[model samples]
Target: MSKLKVAVIGCGSIAKHRHLPEYAQNKQVEIVAVCDIVEERVNEFATKYDAIAYTSYEELLANQDIDIVSVCTPNYLHASISVAALKAGKHVLCEKPMATSKEEAEEMIREAEAAGKKLMIAHNQRFVPAHQKARELIEKGELGKLYSFRSAFGHGGPERWSVDGKDSWFFRKEEAFIGAMGDLGVHKTDLLRYILGEEFVEVGAFVETSSKKNADVDDSAVCVLKTENGIIGTLAASWSYVAKEDNSTIIYGEKATLRLLDDPINSLVIQYIDGAVVKYELGGIQTNDIGGQSSSQVIDKFVHAIIQNEESPVSGSEGLKSLQVVLSALESNETKRIVTI
Candidate 1:
């Protein structure tokens, strides 16, 4: 069987760190083209991948040989690029916070449906081994009835990971939509839904651009969420964790507490009320942190979905639902009241 022809729409840090390498590793994919607004970046990635380069996504999508497109552009451009790719008869793997608004995300999904092509969101946290294991344990009722939880994702800000350093699109509200919430909080929202198998129906938040100087977007945000089944919890996304990346979650239950990616050594720690503790040495969540070492399974799953003609693990609708959570959080912050999904 001929390998699927893949084209990446943005040659940014995420495309470099996760999408490009993983797709390169996939024997079933042939990276045929790369696109970026910057000529230098597009040319560089094209040379590295032995693919064609384009400064415009429209030009790249015009290639009839392309079978799949990864929309790795800014948060605001996600819907437009994915919609264009889907209309051009190519499957799409879009990065998370699928779009700036629910309506736009729905439009992307509608376009993918109309084109009869697969659309997957790159919510890589759900693909982490420790998170997968946590989902399994929860589904098996190992933690008993869930009561409350706290999930947070933070780093030293986009200056470190973004290709353009501090000048990246991440800090601009016009391009990023909603700062830390879109970048980090949505990952937690999606993970919580996957782990608990429930939707966040309501949220109250205190989103702000507290720390980072002269930034239009948020440096820190803390949201309190209530699930449909009465599960209450806190979700925090910050770009001010200069000390270290803190991608951690703690789930409390009747019998035990599950700590995910909390400790430096143990990726998962489960402590019981009866003085028993369980620890797993799973690798850290892929936070793009220097010390964090883990590869994503997102590319593999996306390829399999295309091959099998099945919906992706993080389908467009599912991704939109997660995006709605972030939107609701933003609304909650503005209104200073709980917003219902």
Candidate 2:
């Protein structure tokens, strides 16, 4: 079979670091085109990847040879671009916080179904090695009777990560739709859901813009979440950790407690109530720090799904479910009440 043709929209930091590199590494894929609002950036990526360059996504989607589209644009454009790509008979791999609202997310899923194309959300956290192991252990009853947990994803800020640096859309509320919660929090929410095998049913939050200077969006947010299985936990998303990054989750259970990405050396550690300790140096989680780029395994799964005509590991509906938690947190912050999912 001929290699699947792929086009990437938004040649921003995500495309630069994650989608582009991974897609290029996939032998089943051919990078056929790249699109961005910035002519220079698109051309640069096209030259680097040996693909066609276009400034308009509509124009790029018109290329019938392109079988896949990676929507790595700002959070606001995710729904529209994915819907258009699906309508154009192309599979879509969209970045996190798939849509700004419930209606938009539903529309994307509906269009993907109607088009008979795959729509996968790029929630890379689920693909982390330690996270996968944790899920396996939880499923095997290693952590019996979970009591509570805490998961946090934080760093200095997105400015250093975005291609545009300080002028990036990450700090702009109009373009981003949200700040820390949508950018960082949504990933943890998805990871927790995948690890625990449950849906978040209720949430109360204190989302605020505490640290980033001159930013209209929330820079820090802490939410209390309750899962359908009666598991209660704290989820924090922040861009204000100026000193260092913290991408860790601690799960307290009746038998043992699982500490993930907590220690610098051991990515996962399990301590039993009966004085037993287990450690696994399964590598660290992905971070914004230089040389922290690890294979997310998202693009590989997406390519395989399309080739085998199978459902995406992280489908649009799943993305919507994760997105609902963040949306509820935002609502909870506004209403100061526990919002029900």
Candidate 3:
């Protein structure tokens, strides 16, 4: 089969670190075009990958040969770019959270359906080996009626990691909509739903701009969720941690408990009430150029889905679910009360 001709809509950190590298590595994809508002970055990527570069995403979307479009733009532009690409008869792989608001997400979904194109979101945590194993265990009923869970994701800040540093959209509420909640929190939101196989029903949250000078967005946020199945959990996401700690999940079930940690390699520990414990080490999950191990897995899955004409594990609808959790959290924080999904 010929390679799927792909175009990237944003040449930011995520595009450089995850999407471009993974697409370059995948034998099934031909990254034919790259687009970014920043001409220099787009040109550099185009030269490195031997692809055409565009200063505007609309120009790239006009290219009839492009089969896939990866929307790696800011949260606010996700819906517009994705809807345009889908309407242009191209499959789309959008980054999470799917959009700045639920209405936007719904519009994108509607457009994709109308165009009869696949719409996948980059909720890569679902592809992590530890997360995959947890899902498997839960599906097998080994956890035995989950009672509750806890998860968190934190890092220093985007200033050090983003190519734009302090000027990155991450620090701007207009472009980012929300800070740590949308950036790091959504991953946990998606991961919890993937592992638990339940949707969040209600949320009560607290968000603050506790650190980061001159930033208008929250640097730290915490939320408690009640799942539709009666499982309750807490998620903490922050940009204040000096060192990264992607620690996640303590699922308490009737017969046993499971713990997941991404650092020091992806490891899962399961303990039973009868004094038996099991440990699984997933080693490295092939994160692209960055430390996003699950991203590599996600790209691989995306390519497979394109080749097989199948549904993505992290579908656009699944991404919307996570975004709904974030929106609910924001509403809860603003209202000082629980918000229903």
Candidate 4:
């Protein structure tokens, strides 16, 4: 069995920290090509990884040897690039906020299905160790009958970590299509869906741009969400956490309250109603503060899915569902009404 050849479509921060390095670590993969509009960035990656460099993604996609495409471009380009890659007979592993619109997300899924290629969205929160452990315990009914939860992912802002700093496309609506909600909020939305095995049915939100100056998009957003099973809670995404990054979730249930990624020493803690407590130092959740972790498990799952012809763990459909929740939150913020998913 020959190694699968991969071409990364964008050489941005995500490509540098997560997709590129993680794919290189996969023994079954070969980093065949890298592309970015910036020649210097692409050339740097190509030199580092021993792959061909291209300033145009289309030209890179034209390479017949590439079996996989990692779409690490901005939010606005996710749908188009993934669709093109699937049409070109390549499996796609796209970054989060898979598309800026619900319609776009559906089209990407449709194209992947038409091409019979796997389409995965990089919602890595579901792959975190503490998150995986929490899901397992929830499935086993340890956190019986989940009632409510609060999940937040906030940091100093993308400018601190993005390759272009303050000039990064993340703060530009034309490229990002959203700010903190799409960048950070979507992760928590997807994780809640995965951990609780439920879908968010309704949302009412307050999305604002109060924190970051001169940015047209929201830097802070707070959403009240209700799941299909009647569980309700708050989801927050902010670029205003000037001191430290807070990527934490607290789940309330009839049996026990699960605290995930909240404590510095213990990644997961279970506090029972009867006063019994349990703690597990699973591992730290990936953060921009540390330039992310070495392995998110997302790349590995995507590789295995393609090799074994199995459905992706974070499939296009799953991505669309999560995108819908965020879209609903945006709509709710504007309409001042609870939006139903």
Candidate 5:
């Protein structure tokens, strides 16, 4: 069996931390090419991964030999790069937020459909062990009719994980689209959707840049969301948690409450109304912890889907829907009214 040749566009923190390393670890994938606008970063990654390097993604995509293209670039470039890769006969595994707008996301999905290629979004939170387990439990009726939920994804800031530190693209609204919401909130939205098996129909949001000096984007944002099945929830995304990262979700049900990624040791816990409590010591969510266990199951699923000729685990359509949630929040914030998805 020949390995799938993979090319990663944008050799920044995410490329180095998740996409490249995970692809390299997958036996079915070969990290054949790496790209970055910066010559130094591209050259360094090429050496590290023992692959060819390119300063331009356009040049990398021209090599018809590449089977997959991973877009780890800024939010604004995700759609264009993914569409281009799909049009060039390459499957795309794009990072989160999918695109700056819903139309761009639709374009990416359309291009992939036209090209007949897999278009997976790197919404890794849905792949976390705890989250996977939570969904399984919920589906099996262990949680017993979920009613409400609250999720939050926050950290010190992007400087700790971004290659450019203070001047990272994450802080620029033009490049990032929406800072904390796009970077962190969307992951929670996707996760909640996956767990509850529902879509957010309405949202009321307050998106702002309360922290992070000189940043042209929101440093924090919170949304009040209502799913199609009458499920209501709150989502908080922020870069203002200077002390520690808070990646937690609490799901309330008629019979029990599921706490995910809430405890340091438990990772997942269920507290029932009848005084029965269950705890599972699952793997923790990725915090980009300065090199401490930061890979996702996304690459494995992406590879398996391609090898098996199946739909991607997080398909382009799924990405588009999740992105619609984020965009709805932005619209809600702008109008100070509940926006419908």
Candidate 6:
């Protein structure tokens, strides 16, 4: 079969690090177009990839040969761009925190359904080797009856991470929607749901803008979740961490406790009730960028979905499940009561 022709919209950090590089690596894909509001970024990416560059996404979407589109723009643009791509008959892989609100996410889903195209959200953590292994174990009943789990994701801030740091859209509520909760918390929320194979039923949360600098959005957030299976746990995320720690979950089950940390590499520690401790040192999963390994995995999966005619690892509906957790957390924080998820 011929290679799938793909186009990328929004030549931002994620496009540079994850989607572009991964698509370039995939023998089944040929990136035929790149777009960004910033002409310079689009030009550089298109030049590097040997693809056509456009300043407007509309121009790129007009390419009838493009089989897939990756929307790497900010949180707010996800729905509009994805809907357009789907309507244009191209599969879409959108970045996580799928939309600023549930309504937008629903619209994107509807568009994809109407267009008979795939719409995936980039919740790449689902593809990490350690996380994947843990999920398999849990599904196979290796963890026995699950009890609870805790997870967190945070960094110094997005200033250094983004091309525009403090001035980045991540620091602006209008662009980012919800700060730490949507940025870091949503990933953990999705990870927990994926690993535990349970839906969150309720949430109690505390969101605060503790740091005075860049006070437009939340700096930190902590939430308690109760799963449908009655498993309960805590999730914490922050841009306030002085140093970086990609600390993740500790799932307690009847048979054992499972732990995951992604800093050095993806590592899993499983402790059984009989005092047998098993540690699995799964190295970094292949990603588009080193720091964004999960993003790379997400792109690879999306490409594979296109090639194999299968469902994406993180479909739009699955993305909504994670987003619902974040939304519930926001409501919980505001109302000072447990919010149904």
Q: Which regions in candidate 5 have their CA more than 4 angstroms from the true location?
A: none
What TM-score does structure 1 among the candidates reach? 0.98
**lDDT tens readout by residue for model 6, 154-180:** 767677577776779988888888898
User: What RMSD does each model have against the real structure?
Assistant: 1.2, 0.8, 1.8, 0.9, 0.9, 2.0
TM-score of each: 0.98, 0.99, 0.96, 0.99, 0.98, 0.95
Candidate ranking under lDDT, highest first, comes to 2, 4, 5, 1, 3, 6
Clashes of each: 0, 0, 1, 0, 0, 2
Window of ten residues with lowest summed lDDT in model 3: 285-294
- Score each candidate by Cα lDDT: 0.91, 0.94, 0.87, 0.93, 0.92, 0.85
Select the stronger candidate by lDDT from 2 and 4: 2
lDDT of 5 by residue, 182-289 (tens): 999999999999999998899999999988997999999999999998999899999999998999999999999999999999999999999999999997877768
Tens digit per residue, CA lDDT, model 4, 1-341: 99999999999988999899999999999999999999999999999999999998888888999999999998899999999999999999999999999889999999998998999999999989899999999999998999999999999999998899998899889999999999999999999999999999999999999988868899999999999989999999999999999999999999999999999999999999999999999989778954566789999999998899998889989999999999999999999999999
List runs of model 1 lying over 4 Å from the truth: 290-294
Better of 1 and 4 by lDDT: 4
After superposition, the stretches of candidate 3 with alpha carbons farther than 4 Å from their true spots are 262-266, 284-295
Q: Once superposed on the true structure, which residue ranges of model 4 sit more than 4 Å away at CA? A: none
lDDT (tens digit, per residue) of candidate 1 on 142-243 = 999999999999988999998999899998889998898889999999999999889989999999888888589888999999999999999999999999
Looking at model 1, residue 192 earns an lDDT score of 95
Scored against the true structure, residue 193 in model 5 reaches a CA lDDT of: 95
| Per-residue C-alpha lDDT of model 3 across residues 91-142, encoded as one tens digit per residue | 9999988899888999988998898888999887787788889899989999
